[model samples]
Target: MSNTSTSSDTSGLSAGATAATIALAVVGGIVVIVIAIAIIRCIQKNKMQARNTSMQITSVSAVNVDSNIDMVTIERFLADIVKERPVRFTTQNIIDFTQNFAQKLGSGGFGIVYKGQFPNGVQIAVKVLHKTQDKRAEEQFMAEIGTIGRTYHINLVRLYGFCFDNTLKALVYEYMEKGSLDSYLFDENQKLKWEKLHEIAIGTAKGIRYLHEECQKKIVHYDIKPGNVLIDANFSPKVADFGLATLCDRDNSHISLTGGRGTPGYAAPELWMPYPVTHKCDVYSYGMLLFEILGRRRNLNLSQAESQEWFPRWIWHKFEGGELDGVMTNCRIEHSNRDKAERMCKVALWCVQYQPDTRPSMNSVVRMLEGEEEIIAPTNPFQYMMPFDGSSSQWSESRGYSTSTATTTNESEANILIHQNQQ
Candidate 1:
């Protein structure tokens, strides 16, 4: 009996030891899990704080020169960018590549572009900025470097490198063999296929949409035109020239600018007024560009035949009159492309709506172009007039401005009359 009791006691003690070991392990595991979660939360909080601080510093630095940019921060940002991008070239390097700047591409408001070929036989377009004493050139240089340098898209022009030595500043980009879309679209002999034009339009829209919605920051191109749209060797459209770009927080609906930016005819009508601008401004310019692509002519060709003096007006007249077949007869749009062509016209009209609110987002524009969404007929863009001085004489004296009269129901006719009156 004594031996049996001793064995039972030993087994009970062993069971208790095992149970205690497992309980201790469970407690230890719970503690470890809590520590890991706490660490993760603390790290996330620190990161959020860092981002907020960086944004605050950037906002302040933009307005105050005394508050110098965080060089360390900029260097880090540039370091990450350089990790995957081409290195910055010296002015001498650019000169060597360009053969002493021999082949000039063209000049713009900011600078001249020259075609350059590297020793490796790779070609590039070197945009040499015009030296300026004012802050405009510096602002533009910084804007382009900061915006385009960080962005990468097949539809967006690629900035291979840049140079900022002494007074010489330049941006080197991928060489576009076909040149600007503006050059070919209007060439009488170089008529682009309707399918090709449609592809160009959709590609351009995707690029803009990416800028507005996909980028880390919301970028308003502010200038979307045929001149800014470069055609690659494959005839694909690439959005270029970020000189007029403005950045805003992604969550923000609109941004306020002191003054308007963009080419006159292509600029949104609201840009002339004191209003907060949005990515919609780009939409308006794209609308104007779409119209030009469809018409195969400049929107404001005052010297063209009377019917086509203002391309938008002429096209609008055709659209309203249900004469879409004759709208772009010169382009030789085929029966299959007729629907595509008409959809382009409808989308263009929607984009150039008098009110920015009425315009569809670029994403929506893409869907309509892709035939995913039904396009509604846009209202007559000119039926709604810009609020000018409330007198016809003042309107008449304004040269190109006109009043809304019942007889002038057609906006195109009104613009035609204005052009004639000015002449």
Candidate 2:
């Protein structure tokens, strides 16, 4: 009887322990499932927040683009981006390629560019954006690459790789041996032949046409001065420096902008008017640039004897007087040269028409250059301008301010303002 009681009690204890163990296991499983569900919900919420933030950013950019993003924000955004097409490079790689960035190519509103060579004998140009506490620099870096990466054309600068490690930010591009067009345009020492100049003009037009018509989105190059046009060894022109570029839907013909953009001389008049900008702004700038190329000098000259009259207006006066020879003394009266000069002048005047709608599209400009369409005499670009005596020096009077400041103090301050406003 004692043995039977002891066995029965032992069996009952064993059953109770097994039941308690299973209960504990079930409670633990419930807690694990609940925790996992909470984690998943948290992840979903974070994703939603990110999407909302992106929409907000787009909205803000559409309304007013004040400056580029700060360093921290750009670093984070670049980290999250998966760039499959553009190759990524480390800071060490860039250092090795550039030989510690020894060969300085040039400096601009953006930053200093360095000439680099790879082991494969490929030469590259690395543009390092100016660093600043303001997030606008970061925004410009991203904006430039974003535009370049998506664009592919023989007339457009090719991007190879990028580096964004710590404080270093640079864009690697195929080097143009001949350098910027401005270097040669104003260089009396290396004057390009008339044929070569015409070729460059057409090639540049094709590039701009591509940006405006051929791309998935219409890209407006806010700055189209000679400095931004690069020339390769073969004298082929490729458009570069997209710091002030803006992308719009293919269907949309215009864009709303807050402040101003482009260099003082090359900037369209509408930019100063603070009107709604469009691709035509580029046409207007191209007109100004063409005038520079034709005259082989800056359009506005403060020190000239005729400082009051605008250069374009002066050129128009000479053109109307039937003395093209007097306008640009260098342009000879030879048959081919005269034809080319007259065509370019007419096209430029059309481009710089005070009314934005009067400006021809890049495609039309290309056709006009090629002599495919009938050329019409353009009205004077500055016909409506009233001479200002600097009497009323405020608001509208500021437009007449000389873009070229001789003093160092004013130049430095103007440069800062230009960098903030343009590419």
Candidate 3:
């Protein structure tokens, strides 16, 4: 072979070898980075596992529990939920999946709700819960689910599972064709057309009644606004958010020591303020829902009475005096059922009465809405109205919520909160 030809072949071979080495080095560096990241993650995960193990709650005393009761229904509900075998979301899955066609449902103390569909052809509503990285929030979220997962009522929203494996901690629910009652009732879709609104009202009343009377334990949904309620394909109302529910025995006080959880405008002031309350707080929220149905979400601000300082009082007065026609945004529907509208308005007012004693049980509410029983006019509402500016003190004492007897559980103890009758 000629020297010149041999040298040319060797030179080409050397260049190719150099290129391959550089490529291999680049690949090696990438692998090292990935390995380092994975190792750090493993160490962090171990620490987290250790921390969670340390924080588990062991046991708690029931303010009043019947030890001899047969727990068949509760067991059945839990069995059904477990059979579904929902799992948490992993960060990798979210990164790989693109959220498709999400519509904003609502927002509150919780983050937000968006409607989305999975690639597997499943429709889901995702509730991005409010709290982030807070242990207390995690406890509350679990409390709501654990309590509700024990039963599947026609009225309650269906929980598929949750996503807690990573930073993506959110609740996954079956998508409802119709969004929250709040949007439907107030929006220009002419939602509060009397017939549709009335039907919704009846459905919601039935759901609440189930919570009160049908369930093994009474669950008080402190927040019952339109947003918390959702409509199905058949337009049946399903109570959506269980975030603020308190489950307790029926015979016991609805609230034991005191305090209630709900939105500011809808919550019964007396129950929320001085504490010690019952299902009446829910009744109050229902009243507000009724108002939303009839008022068509008109009064973001309710007016007050002469003695009644709160704005809800103002809205109530105008409603009773038949000023609803003027204030109602969905007035066009009244032409079809004026008397029906009037009856519903009266029922709404009755449920919202300031005194818990006067408010009807959810059973009564359902019956009244169905026209199976007549709804009587509520007694004077402001009877418990504050006499002085600091009337909060007297009201607290009178309502009888002694925090001295409040549930004595530490934050570390993870038992869910339930309410019952006052002893």
Candidate 4:
């Protein structure tokens, strides 16, 4: 009876072990299937991610290609249009000419100007443009090449060649021995003779006249500051820095601007506003430049007495009060140069008139500066700054200006009013 009982127990244990083994196998199969499915899903996810990454890369590459093509097209168009094609130099040539950037002439917002030389001992100023993510630098480069490359004038700086490599972009220009006009005008120690200054002013006016009237297309040099007027060994003035210059059809009454394009103190009132601008805007800038040239100092001098704080305003006061002789005396003008100085002052006033139509053409300015044409006395250029007190004759200190019937109590208020009017 004991043996039979033991046998029954053994049989039951074997059956239970078999059932447990079958359950374990089922669980193992399910786990294996789950792992295989997970692996497949991970592979698909990786492939999808790779595809997305590739698509993004392709999109970025396409954009880069388009930008490159646009630049190339501009280069080709400029080359074709320009009568005298400037020499296209390689990056290595730039490095060699610049002597690996050994002598830096100067630097500005655009880039550095390095003194360079050619094999034949011809001196050049190589302006290496700053690399930009946007196309502004490229646009400016093309503009300089397009405009100046097409024309040649004694008063205009000459662009000899250019390097438009992927890594380095530069412009090769004829070197000016005396540097910029501002160096002499602004420096107390470097005061030029009034006669020379007058000559420079006339030359600058002629340059502007050429741009406005003589060129096939009118090129308005929007930034006509002293810094842009370069002088050579002969003290001859040449207009430089055509980065802000724009070419327009002669028939177009005005040109549209995306934004203001000049030094603040020298910029026209219209440039700050959204008004459709004409070449007269350059006249206004030239007027501001004339103010600086007249003073041999900045337009705004806080160090001066209250009466003479703003040079233009003081000059206007003196001019209107029939004390232009006093202004000439203050500027230390020689007796012989007084007529030229007075002419410059009058021309400046006319150029800065609020109404664009009222401004004299650059041709007229040249004629006036050269004493070839009579300069009619200029009306008050600061009419915008006329006092609120019913008197139209004089500027009052206590009462500020008016813009379109609204009285502005302060300069800031006046600016806002002017901006609103422009809008």
Candidate 5:
């Protein structure tokens, strides 16, 4: 009887052990399934955010735009982002393939650009935007790639690949051997010659014209300054930063804030006006850029103190009298080149006319620059008042006292344009 009882006890213990093992296995399987679901949700959430960029802009208020964000706020926003996808480089994997390729060419708000080579040994410029915290960054990354990808022109910069991952957001492009026209023109050391400068201006005008007329979509290169103009090995000018504004705008216009998106000197007067700006504003900016290139001067700091200004009426006197050529003439600006200089100066003076209607389109400018026909002399520019800052001796007697400064100093989609010192 005692032996039978012991056998029953051992059998019961074995059964209990088996039941416990099954329970443990069931719990482990459930945990794995839960983890997988969570990861999938995270990825989907990120992708969804990237697609809907307008929501982020909608979240902000007009009243709060001026007061809402500062360095601290931006810092907090960056910290909140959780990276889920890492950038996947799709360039060729072979060393001989992408090696001589992807050489770090330059760096900007976008990450460092790499020179990339394909299996066919094609050369391209790659601008890699620095990795950032959240979906906003990813949206910007994709927006630039998507917008620029669709836009193709011999004069416009080309986009190849955009890496949208948890760790990276980079752009691949066709490399421009010469950097920005701003560097070549204003770099004091390597300033271009008269004929080359003339060609650059003409090429740039054609590029801008193509954006306005030839492109499938109407585009306004809001930032049409020297920094954004690139020259190829053949000295052909191509417009970079082509689709930048649209990228930040989520591919639409008619936004709440438009005033402070461009450089101070190059920005249109409408940029400071109360009404929302439009494509005409780009025409105004293009005008300023044209003048800056020909004048060989930076207009932003033309008058720091009211007393230190050299402006509109003064410049007009110089231009109409044909003495404007003397002002921009350095060693590079010569007597033999005076005729070309005068023609460009006349064109420059005409471009910055105060009224939008008075300004010519880039297409017209291109034809004029290409020497297609003789350009007409400009009418007198409308006189305007700028609020003065107590002193007015250094400037002309016709100083307006407008002290307001137009600056889109803090913007995401806007360029980080600084006050470049003029010679």
Candidate 6:
């Protein structure tokens, strides 16, 4: 009986052990399955992250490709230029020439200019262009190379070479020791003689004439302010800064401009308006420049009296009133320069004529300034300021002049008409 009882106890103990082992196996299997699932999910997550990173990289590459398109165009243009001019320089060359950009000469909206020297000790002005999102820097770079790169003139600034690299872009120019013309015109301490100023005016006109009539493609120097005129050590003027310049086929009667391209006071009215523009727009800007040169003051100066606030209007008033001598005296013109000053004043009036066709060609301007061509008395350039009355020989003072009755007349008659209208 005792043996049988012991056997039953042993059997029960073995059954309990077997059931516990089975339960443990089931739980272990579940844990292993859950771990496998977790591992798979983690792998998928990693793959998704990698795909997203690749997509982002592709998007960036697409933008780079677009940018590269412009770069390629510029490179091709430069490559062609290089074949003829040998004016291409590497980024390392730029660094060497500019000595790591040690000497900063000036800074402007475009970028900084550094004084540089070559291996042979020839000095240069390195204009490093600002990187812009709008690609204006690139456009200006192309314009300078396309226009001035092909032409050479005594009065035009010389572009020595250029640096176009993946991370840098710059223009190398001949250094002008005397600096820009505005330094002399605006600074009282840096005064130039009237005779010298007259010569500069002629030189500038000749440069413009060359651009207008001589170049294979007519280049309109959209910005012709005194700031763009550089003076050499000998005080010779050279037209510089062709960033705003545009080239048009000579056969095109009017050039299509996307937008205005000059300083406010110097910009032609037609530039702001939706009018058909021609190289005559440059003539208009040059006229504004002449007014500044005549007074050695800005065209628009609020510091002066109300009548004298706009220098061009003041000159017109004095000129129409037969007080041009007063105008000359006010400008402190030398006695010997009175004739030259008068000619400049007349040329300016004609240049600013409301009708572009009435304005003389730059060739005629050169001739007139040199006293080789006759300057017919300029009709009122500011006729819009004084409207004419068709019923009578007078201009309407209240509302300004009528365009229909505007006619070309001699200086004496135009002055009389203006005086009568004032009365």
Model 3: per-residue Cα lDDT over 1-423, one tens digit each: 599999999999999999999998988988999998899999999988887665542112231232312365577778766745455655544333326324555543435555655666766766666555455556657766765655576777777666675456676677777656666766776354578778888888888888887878888876676767777777777876676577888789757633445554566766556756887888888887787676564334223323333334554566657576754433454466766766676777788777788888888887777777886765556556654342465433322211212211211011111100000
Query: Candidate 2, residues 72-163: lDDT per residue as tens digits?
Result: 57877785453324567888988999899887765545577778887779888777666642465566677677887788888988777788
Question: Quick one: how many clashes does candidate 1 have?
Answer: 0
Question: How many clashes in each candidate?
Answer: 0, 6, 14, 0, 18, 5
Better of 3 and 5 by lDDT: 3
**What local lDDT score does residue 91 receive in model 1, on the 0 to 100 scale?**
85
103-156: candidate 6 lDDT, tens digit per residue: 777654556678889897978888887765236657877888888887788898
> By TM-score, how accurate is candidate 5?
0.62
For lDDT, the strongest prediction is 4
Better of 2 and 5 by TM-score: 2
How high is the lDDT of residue 250 in model 4?
95
The stretch of ten residues in a row with the least summed lDDT in candidate 6 is 405-414
Lowest summed-lDDT stretch of 10 residues in model 4?
413-422
| lDDT of each candidate versus the true structure | 0.77, 0.74, 0.62, 0.78, 0.59, 0.77
TM-scores, each model vs. reference:
0.70, 0.70, 0.61, 0.71, 0.62, 0.71
User: Candidate 1 has which clashing residue pairs, if any?
Assistant: none
RMSD value for candidate 1: 18.0
Model 4 stretches astray by more than 4 angstroms: 1-84, 386-423
Candidate order by lDDT, decreasing, is 4, 6, 1, 2, 3, 5
Which stretches in model 6 have alpha-carbon errors above 4 Å? Answer: 1-86, 385-423
